[model samples]
Target chain A: MTRRVVITGMGVVAPNGVGLSAFETAVRAGESGVRFIQELADRNFACQLGAVPPLEASHLQVLTTLERKTLEASGIIYGLLAAVEAWSNAGLDVPGNEEDPDWESGCIFGSGIAGAEVMRDATYLIDEGRVKRLGSGAVSQVMASGISAYLGGRFGLGNRVSSNASACATGTESLLLAAEHIRSGAATRMICGACDSGGPYAWGGFDAMRVTNRRSNEAPEAASRPLSATAAGFVPGCGAGALVCEELESAIQRGATIHAEVLGGAINSGGQRKGGSMTAANKEGIVRCIRHAVENAGIHPREIDAISGHLTATLFDPIEIEQWSVALERSGSQFPYVNSLKSMVGHCLSASGAIEIIAAILQIKGEWLHGSLNCENLHPKIAECIDPERVPQTFRKHAVRTLAKSSFGFGDVNTCAILRRYDPE
Target chain B: MAPSRPDIIDRLHRIVEPYVEDEEALTSVDEDTNLLEDLSIDSMNLVDIILDVEEEFGIEIDDEAAEQMTTVGSAVDIIASRLAAAD
Candidate 1:
């Protein structure tokens, strides 16, 4: 028998807020985290604005001396911090004198570019013939699997510790993979999340692609205007998000505080076929992915109470809205409430799916849908697909039974997960 | 000028300060104080400490010698010998 999966704990190191409570509060208040970065301006980038987690010196207190001295990777730092918060929030004890690791607990933390900052530093050191000064931990810090490796060692988890990379779909895909692991009894619990580096090294490529909003350098907060007619492009963002997915029975036995049930999900790629390209999704592929996720979740399309879309404040926002409308076979007043965390925190790249998942779960747990920020002038096309009322402009207290969250990535990959309010039988 | 044994040990203490969890334990650390047990410095961290020592004293200690540095005294001895060899 397939075991049911549930979220027992969640943690986020977001641009808007460092912890879960702060993140929820910021999102609920429609607070924007995007800011004009002076470093980007100094580098003469087209997009001088980005969202970065405001990590204070206090945030580094948890790191051991070795970790603090040698760790230069921001993504790993963020990922590890978020993982620790999630682990503690789950009420799991840190292995002190145990000879063996927790075989039942695993980690699947994902990253797009794990250690760009470290790599840049290493490259400079190598060029200067200071290669020997690179330090022993430098390689680990730059490795793509660094986040998972560090987390696995820190938590003493012996099961399936791995990292997945699928651009923006990574975080959502990690959760789906964790749920599958739990359902198949390979592991009783899994720590799933993703992180992305901020600043020029990571965002330079996006800026060069001219895909980031460059017009809002002066008014940083208003830059990420998803679903708006004046929406320019996605604001680059960085940070990490994590969730602990445990077997429902194990969680209940441990007396863990259950948050939401992971009602199945679907992951698919457009294969860059038909109208799909390296960056854009094929319309049919997205619709199929969403429908399959809802079907696999054992829920009808109309039962979806809300949608946390992959609306990255790009021109594709309306197209995403239309796809959701077609996939669920509901539109206008019948359409569910839809929102995008990117409107506040910007697109966090690999970390977006995981951070947004936390936002979605919060909405379900609180029974309130936080409005998408800066979308007051809703795109005409999107307005035609869904009622303006469905696109709330402010936080609204409403009952959200089942919420569908979708993530689309650069490789034309798609992942959708359905989360339901846990009702113990 | 080559540093004295006590000077090297004092510098080693400063280098290992960040990795040492118990700040008080560092004060009483002697030749017998195990780097791993007493200072909570792991093998990976031992490597960093050794590298920093080499950079600070302008001497190179091979990996085998580094592995043998299990205690504060051993680290001091290794650095002293490496410095003498350089001289």
Candidate 2:
């Protein structure tokens, strides 16, 4: 028997806001987190604008001095803080002192490029013959699995503790992986999330590729213009998002608050074939992923009330809209309400999927659809595919029963998750 | 002015305070305090404490000596000897 999975708690350290309440309010108001970063400009980056979570030192007061001393990796710090919030939000004990780990709990946290800053520092120290000065924690911080390993140790989770990387789809893919673990009865609960570090080091390559927005560097607030006619390129962003997925029965047994039910999802790769390339997705593959997700969720496309899109404010925004329209066979007035978190938080890279999923769940629970920022002048092609009324320019209160959220990465990989309002039968 | 032996031990206590896992050990840390047993400083954190000492005292501690710094007194001895040699 397949076990049912539901989101019991969620936490977000987004560029727009550090916590769920703040983030939800910012998104509802269409607030932009993109800003002019002086460090990027000093480094001679083409696009000097980026979005970064405003993390203060007090946010990490729970860490020990040793942990703080060794904490050079920004991604790990963000991931851990977000995980703690989610754990507590689920009404779980913080700093649990159980003699043995809860063998049923696990984590599948991901980071696209972990510890680049620490690696760079280590390289410099080693080059200068100060190898002893390269602290022992350097290796742990630089490893791709650092975030998951740290979380596993922190929470005493004994189940499969692992990290996954698939560029931008990492966060969404992680949630789907956790759902499979529960569905197959491998684990009862799992903490899944993804994080990315901000700065010139993490975003230098994209800046060099000229894939970041350079047109609105002076007007940082309006830089990330997703699904708009003035859209240029994506603005690099960093932060973390976490969700606690628990078995439906397990959550109810523990009297946990159910945020939303994980109906089902699908993941696929285009193999970079046909029109797909290293940086672009195949339209057919996208459509297939969406259809498979809806089918797996045992819901018809017409049942989807809203869409949380991976619209990165690039030229591909219209293409993404078209793919969704074709996959659902809905266009013009028939199209579902669609919004992009990237419009406010910029492109959070690996963290985008989970962060956007948090926003989607919040909207579903609150019975409202947040507006898509900077899309007032919608792209002509996107307008041709969906009616302007379907894309709200401001927040609207409407009951949404089911929501579909998707994330597509640079390597032609796609993941779509179907979420439904929990109506216990 | 060069720090005396007692001064070095006191300073080491402050430096080691951060990495100590046991609160009681932190309160009564002295020359005989076993870094591993009393403070519960793992090998990874030991390396960081050693690095901190090196930076604080402006001395070079090779890997061989760093491995032998298992107790608070042992660390103080190494730092004092290195300081004397420099003088």
Candidate 3:
């Protein structure tokens, strides 16, 4: 029999809030994290409004003063903060250097813009003929696996400590893969998460592409209007989110408080074909991914109590909604309740999936759904696909037993995860 | 070299400030202080310290000389000798 994977703890360094409790409170209250970025405006970015974690360098107390000074990669900072919080929140002690490595533990933390700024700095140094001053940590800072490597060493994890990047789908994919590793007996505990640098350098390309909303620079809080008629484009955002997935048996034996269970999920790509491209998703691929996820979870589509969609405030929001309706074989009034965290936090790129998952788990645990900020005045297409009541515009108390979450990334990659409230049988 | 060993050591003190683990130990550091054992600086960081010293002095310490810089006194001797040769 396969082992079951349950989330014992979670941590979020999200645009809206930095810690679990703060994030939960902010999410439930529907507080917006999107704001006007002066730096972006100075850089002449079309989209000056963005969502970034309201954090200062002083808040990162986990690193030594020297290490923090040497660290130039923001992804590592965000990822480290969230991962450390998740590890401690799981009641796992941070292993001292003298202790043996935790061979049963591992991590799969991910990042999209890990070392962009550091590399830019390196280039400037090289241009100035000061390559010798690049320092020893420069390579580590610029490495793609920097976040996972730093986390692996910090926690002394010996098993499968690796990183993955599949565009924005990275966060949800990491969770699914982490659960699989435990279910396959490769690990007893795994920390899975994703982060984005959220610096101007990281958001510059998206703004250049005009995929981010620029019209709402004055109305920052209303910028990310997911599924709304007045929706522009997604507002670029960045941060980190993490979850500690432990074996169900081990968690029970250790008496760890179980938050939720991972009921398996599916990850797939659209092959960039049939209307799928660098920026758009193929509808058939999304439908297939969800149907497979439900089948993998050993549950029927009708059992999904709610959905957390990859509904960035863009033209694709309605498409994602209709795709979900098609995947679950449910329509109109029969559609399950749905919400998108992007409505408040903007599209956090790679971190969005993990942040959304944490919000979903919170919903299941708290028995309430946060309002989808700015989802009012639903687009005519979205209104036709799902019942207006299914999309909540304000926070409400409700029962969320099995919530399904899906994330479609830049390359038409998609991952749908099924989460259930932990129930001791 | 015109600059004395004490001058080099003073400069070295500033360079090693960020790499060493024990600020207390570094505060009382002498020529005999071992970078690894006394200052608790990781050996890998010694490579970085060497780079910084090169940048500060505008002189490259060969690998052979770099390997011998285990203690503050030894580093001073090598860097001092390099300065003398350059002069």
lDDT of 1: 0.91
Q: Looking at model 2 chain B, which ten-residue stretch has the lowest summed lDDT? A: B39-48
Which pairs clash (backbone N, Cα, C closer than 3 Å) in model 1?
none
> Residues A170-239, candidate 1, lDDT per residue (tens digit)?
9999999999999999999999999988889989999999999989898998999999999999999999
lDDT of 2 by residue, A1-425 (tens): 66899999898999989888888889888888899999999999999999999887887786666678678888888888888888888877544654788789999999897677888888999999977778788888889899999989888898999998999999999999999898999999999989988888999999988889998878998889889999999999999999999999999999999999999999999889999999999889999999999999999999999999999999999999999999999999999999898989999999999899999999999999988888889999999999989997889999999999999998999999999999898
Misplaced by over 4 Å in model 3 are B1-14, B22-28, B51-68, B78-87
- Candidates 1 and 2 compared by lDDT, better number: 1
Q: What CA RMSD would you report for each candidate? A: 2.1, 1.2, 2.4
Query: Model 3: which residue pairs collide?
Result: none
Residue A358 C-alpha lDDT in model 3: 92
Index of the highest-DockQ prediction: 2
The full ranking of all candidates by DockQ, starting with the best, is: 2, 1, 3
Number of backbone clashes in candidate 2: 0
Compose the digit string of candidate 3's lDDT tens values, residues A150-242.
889888998999888888999999999999999999899999989888768888888888888989889999999998999999998888999
- Give one digit per residue, the lDDT tens place, for model 1 in B3-28: 99889888888888887767888889
Candidate 2 TM-score to native: 0.98
Question: lDDT for model 2, on a 0 to 1 scale?
Answer: 0.90
